[model samples]
Target: MSDAVQTLTIVIPLQVKPRGGRKAMVRPGVLALERRQDVTLIKAVARAFRWRRMLESGRFATINELAAAEKINASYVSRVLRLTLLAPDIVEAILDGRQAPGLDLPRLLAGFPLAWEKQRASLSPA
Candidate 1:
């Protein structure tokens, strides 16, 4: 018998890229990509809209009242409420799991252009 042994190697094309606040495992060949929803973001977006509605509906007197009801911090509630002002496409990107790198809640809430077009240009991948 020969002393040498044969070995086989298999490789799947993939890349680790920064898609948002985290690094993502990117598979190249797959036509339909599986993107798991960021539940925290989804919840935040939903809460923002809901809170806005409640306030507009006069169900809550102030952020403090809403915070008390929700058991969240009043300041945090206000910050989250600002999420309502985010551009629709930005919200859509978050929902679709296609948000740009570093597009986390704090990053978005920190500040965004008031203009929808500017927000889109700044937030989305070029």
Candidate 2:
């Protein structure tokens, strides 16, 4: 060993803890709010489909034509037209009506087939 003393330097590394759960968990209240919003959205979608059918059927050509096709009074069609006052996206779909998978027009119409059939049966008296 040399008479002169040797100096040694020791480095200690610092350990860092990971930050825990920064994001807040979704509460039940938040989930309920989301579900309510979805229900409103679906109802609006159904109304849009109904309006689209009316516009595409060419019944809008005249009050008389519309009344004849819908078998409803002319003034009734005019009143129902008020639904167009809804959002533009809905109005556009109604005007440019396209049938798609999720947007099943037939299923929607079929939902009230019994009511329609009843009206038809009444009209065709024996």
Which candidate has the top score in TM-score? 1
> Where does model 1 exceed 4 Å of error?
1-36
The lDDT per prediction is: 0.83, 0.44
lDDT of 1: 0.83
TM-scores for the candidates: 0.69, 0.28
Per-residue lDDT over 20-64 for candidate 1, one digit per residue giving the tens place of the 0 to 100 score: 689877787332333545668778999999999999999998999
Residue runs of model 2 more than 4 Å from their true location after superposition: 1-60, 88-126
TM-score of structure candidate 1: 0.69
The lDDT leader among the candidates is: 1
Go through the candidates in order and give the clash count of each.
Answer: 2, 1
C-alpha RMSD between model 1 and the true structure: 9.1
For candidate 2, lDDT tens digit of each residue in 8-110?
Answer: 9986544333324454345444543433233333544555446557667863667667668768776655544444343444334433342222433233333
